[model samples]
Target chain A: MTLVLESQLPLLIVMLTLGTVAKVRTVGSGGEPGALSRLGPAVLVPGRMQAPALLVCAAGELVLAAGLLVSTHPFFRWGTVAFFAMSTYVLLELRRRRPDAGCGCFGEVSSAPVGWRSIGRTVALTGLAAVSVWSPVTGWAAAAGWVIAGPPPWYAAAGVALLALLSPEIEELIDRVRYRAPCEQRHGPAESVTLSKLRSSGTWRAHHQDLVSAEPYDSWRELCWRFFAFRNHEDDDVVFAVYLSGRRPAVRMAVVSREGSDSLPDYIPVSA
Target chain B: MGHPSVERRRVLAAAVLGRTGAVPGADPGDEEPLRAVVGEVLDVSPHLITIETPGGVQERLVIAPWATAWNGSDTTPGDLSVGSMVLMRTLRDGRVVERIWADTTRITGTILSITGKKDLTVELDCGPHRGHRSVVIPYRASGRLQVRHPQFEPGYLFDAIGIRRDGASLALLPATSQPPYPARSVPPPPPAYAGTLSRIAGTATWSDTFDEEERGAAYPMLERTDTGCPKTGVSCAGLPYLAVGSLLQVRNVCSNRSANVPVVACGCMAGRFCDRCVECDTSPRGRIAELSPSSYVELGGELIKGCFNAQIGLG
Candidate 1:
């Protein structure tokens, strides 16, 4: 088991190096300024210290990568474990705060939100780092020797490098395949009576001022339903369930009152 | 060793499937029925013509005796010669040239003048006829031209794909241009939200052509169109960054009207919209999100007003 896990060190080293380069480039380009700014708050850095915080983050990534590559000492191995543990924490916090925000972990190349896949990847890296602590190989020299004199030839290094380069793309592809709806299986027609149609309705015009926000209620169903929240216009919070249904394409709207409870069933249905 | 009858059946099956005797599993149906190749004629003979494609690949194709040829207008095969830029359509065999249009001229230049609201006087700055040469683009021919400009004006660059007519003038056909629409200025997005939601403010407008036309061009990755997104697809030359399928919450800045409209088209200056008059700027700021006419009317804005100021937000 140790030999099998130790054999993966070359691939992990390549992936970490590639990730470090990507982070350095992203910091230089300021591609995800929003994500970078949020990082300042996540790590308890001052808001005004965004630039220095980003530099520190980049430098830390470089150090982690260098330490993983050049040293097999318990300090470097433990440092790797701590570094990935910190990364996993920061990513989870960012995910909790801004679920829609780009992870910016691999830079501008990926826009995937920090989700289970990212956390899973970090956990895997942490496990790998822990394994590296017990392994005899230390530094690029030993790893290179392993590749040259080991069972596999130098061509295996090229394959590992190629796989490392494609890691971000593979992650993005996994996200797309997992989350994106297939074309044929889409819920409904591309265009439905959305807020535009609601505003066009006579009932909507009369109650326009009481409007608050239009939130999509359900996406899994064949028809996408949106809940339009409105303030108390006639002494009650108005909730409008607007969606397109039936064969002959028409906008269906139902008004309800939010008297108590946050559930949809708690709202009392009212006619428009 | 197979039986004689089995061997005969196999041979019969191969023949029925249109497989060549020399190559097993090769399907004759794999050959395209009709395909086009554009190149400059290097050599021409009664039986064949050798041409060099734009990619520097030289190909020699056989010309069928019954092949039809046109150079701007209908012409005999005898008229085809060296140095002619030809667009050739070949049959399934690939060797037989079926139809060929030779010396088809394509020009990219700025409009020098407009005559009678139809005819255009263009100064050729690129293509075969370079160096400020004036060419008259007739009104009758302009109708066939696929122009995307918001307005026709001088100083706007155009790409005219047509044939050179009599007297060195170009009979313009399908064409595209980069119209000059002032880029709509967009305000900087708001600071990152501590929560899971973020919002920004922008204006909204409407159009009636949403359902009838293909909106896939605006968001090429999201929507797929059969007729080539950038060419025969809808104009997304308004806001290049806004994808077609994105949903936005819009609230009227002046009135109490608000709605959620999915972007069905891109109004950015691209493709056909690129042909608008030179007055419109093609910058990335001051962008407009167009809506369906019904959407506009529903948003409590008059149709005649064309556009209304509204705060648009994306989560």
Candidate 2:
């Protein structure tokens, strides 16, 4: 029970810090539009209920943080478990729905995407809460007193908690450092006006459903190109290539028939 | 978000991305007559040189009669020999070599002084030449050079493209600014001023009116008023508080660049910006003002490089 209380002390501190950050960020700027927009798909929180839901979530975190600090009862431990479970569920759902959306789990400014690292952190916290629930409550109270009474020890514990909370961000930073390419090799121009115009065209809009999954062509050619893999109305998977040609910039579409198996032909002009 | 901290974080992220080369628009010319090829010289002659490209292909190129070659400072075709490394640019014809640099000395730096519009000096912070260098922009070359910003104020950084003329001098050449392809449509004017009229500190972005292709008339040009007097200022019909001809001061907080500009025309045309000013506002997210390309450049901002964090004050 003593060992369990000791371990849980650091976890509680980390959770308390994270909860405070989440609460402040949620209530910050009136509300975080980027986070709110992503909430609907991740948590089933509807657009109309986003404001109220955010308030409730933020307030709940604050209450939980305060409760954990003063009490060691089974109720608070169970509450920690429940809170961590909900967080893990939300993060997993976010990872599944919109892998590109920032977690907004820690703070509004953190643009880190929800990934296995976030899930792992949540799982670790939930495990700590579950373990602490089984331990006796008497030692937990004494440990909290020690953490508050001793300044040096409290500083050490706070440092450890901060490091634990920042572990995921550090991992992400390492990943970026390992995977990013050199500047000279990766630099390039922005999206061309021709591609922008093609995207805005009526024909492209009409077929946007099909072209949404298109991949841009990677070559330096006279024309800009993109390929789409989409299902037609008949539910048959069709592959086609779209080209933006001419100095004036015009669009031309070509369907690659499986039966024909012919290579790409010369540009077939299509009016915008 | 409305929070100033959030906006600052977003701007800081953009600045970091720009430094990492993650942001696009660094490439000056997507479409130009000159084609660059880097390779090792296998055989050399006065008129022709054979070299192997990195792609493992052997190619022969014709040397132009007036082709200028620079090894470190300046060199002639006679200096080229076997096993020499070179980066060469040739005309689209593939036969006429325009310029070749054996060891190029590129400079990215902040302008320290300007003698006039034709000759400005810069203090190089990056590249092999890491010191002050005088850049001579000839009158003929000025029209074609794609300077990131219009106003050559001290402390504005510029990525210079030219060959080394001497240890402390680089002869400036006109870098390409045209997009790979011409713009298909003219971008509509900026959006209506829906926000309140106050000292708004937000990101600043730029747009240009030097349309060599001549797609549309230059924006915010002077026009004769109904009262028969010449009027020049951005139209501000939608913004009743910020009336037309109102003077506004825009400052780039990051580079310490500032300019006092007048409202020539309203951001909105009939009712809205061409496309909500999405096409014109090149600044990062949470942009506040859209300056004319010249105005943006004059305020020490880059159109292609995207947005710079700025503070807009109503003067």
Candidate 3:
């Protein structure tokens, strides 16, 4: 029983360290505001005091985690138990006061609403911390022993399984991975890419010398091709239609005379 | 179904399959007949075609009866030589090809140097990864090309779509639109607003270039003389005088989520692209901010959708 209680110390220390780091990191304006401001005590705390309150909570958890890791003293162990008990109470209050807000237990990753799973996880954590209060091993000591030994006791595995089951963040992470933008919504190849393709065609090479200017004064897209118009030496409108797709898209050019006569330019076969 | 890793693997596998099996174009000019499958032609016939992917996989496709092939102009598939690179479009079933293009590629980037008089051999900086490619602009195309590309000097952007011949890209036709100035001489943005504009409404796009996880953004413009702006401002489109490391209060109108992100990079490319985002409604033209993927996702942006209707304020 004492060995199982000792095992709980390492788990409690890990949870506290993770929670503390997450809270501290997210208290900044640039970080995920939903991680702290939209959950936990932030829901109930005054607007001006929210960030400071989050920092204070994180500081308390850090101190308790450090104490639990280094010492097997009754003071540190009991402090962890009381911390988790208070967290459970806070989660319950969060659910009642702001049902839409999350527990915010794990920063932005924990933006799920307060529910039975969240409360149950806190209750289990409090129970685990309470059990550790009677143990004679520090979290570091127990962790070192587990590393040297083959594996942790079965109760440690049970604790991990229970916590994993209650973590709503897992589902959210999975949903993120599963999400894919619809085909039409996904970013298309940039205009630069299309322009690159237009420059690489045979028709451009054939009619290259006829244009008075290198820059197309006007360009527009219609269906599968983009049209570019430049003035020829004769002041004629040299218009080129470049197919937008294919390994070798069709490139065709016609010189529009000043009188609006569209005629294909003199075809000059080029060596490839 | 609830296993995180399992679900992730499944979704990733689906994404990969969707990419490999079929890719319909999403752009305005990317119609069904224009959808391309790029590979080296292994075998070609009036009825059947076989191509080898860059990955060495052999893809055997059926050629539609009315399919047309273009080498320089209209040509028969039988004329395309084996081992020649080709781009083809498929029918609805994605197995029957309707159009095939051959021996085409593009040369675009800053002109490093120009050599020769009758037929110029141009050295081009094709971005960072491609390094440099030597393109020869034939004497016939030089006059018109020179007219459109007035600077024609080093540091000017050169773009042309032409054919691959003799192990080099030939400059055939210029790109549809050209940036008038030299690559290094991007004009400064309009002068700073006369008065403080508290809330500027625009679009927010995302880029993974500068640390995907960093909570920062690339603003379109900053004061040209300011020490914080290392690059020349490309467009006179957005709020001016915003410098690097300045905090911006960005809010996504569609999601109603907001975040304060710092300016980390210059969004010169975004400035040049005068476009609107229709995420919720038509956003005003011009990209105000290009956010890191992390910041974008945190503010309820879908990475694949590309942009969001955004409003920003100085923080």
Q: lDDT tens digits, residues B189-240, model 1?
A: 2222222223333334333334421121122122122112322122222221
Tens digit of per-residue lDDT, candidate 2, span A1-272? 35434456545655556755764665565432334554322245665676566566666767666666666667767887898788888878878777776665554433466767667777877776676676554434646656676543444355356546745665655655665432211212233543565566555555556543443322111112322234444433333233433443444443332232232322334455
**Candidate 3 C-alpha error for residue A110, in Å:** 1.0
* Weakest lDDT window of 10 consecutive positions for candidate 3 chain B: B16-25
What fraction of the true Cα-Cα contacts (under 8 Å, chains A to B) does candidate 2 also have?
Answer: 0.00
Candidates in order: C-alpha RMSD to true structure: 26.5, 23.3, 27.0
DockQ for all candidate structures vs. native:
0.01, 0.01, 0.01
Q: Residue by residue across B1-315, what tens digits does model 2's lDDT show? A: 012222122122222122121211111233333345667789878888888876778989999889767663467865776776666767664556766655333333345665655554544322111235556655554554545345445543444445434444453542212222111212222233333344544454432212211111111222222112222222322122232333456766655656555444333211111111223333322334555544553344433344466665543
Off by over 4 Å in 2: A31-35, A39-43, A138-272, B1-261, B264-315
Best by lDDT: 3
lDDT of 1 by residue, A95-180 (tens): 78777655565655445556676676666667666766677765576567675776744444554554445345575666656655
Model 2 - which docking category? incorrect
CAPRI verdict on model 1? incorrect
The alpha-carbon deviation from the true structure for residue B40 of candidate 1, after best TM-score superposition, in angstroms, is 60
Which candidate tops TM-score? 3
Return the TM-scores of chain A for each candidate in numbered order.
0.51, 0.50, 0.64
User: What TM-score fits each model?
Assistant: 0.31, 0.33, 0.36
**Model 3 CAPRI quality:** incorrect
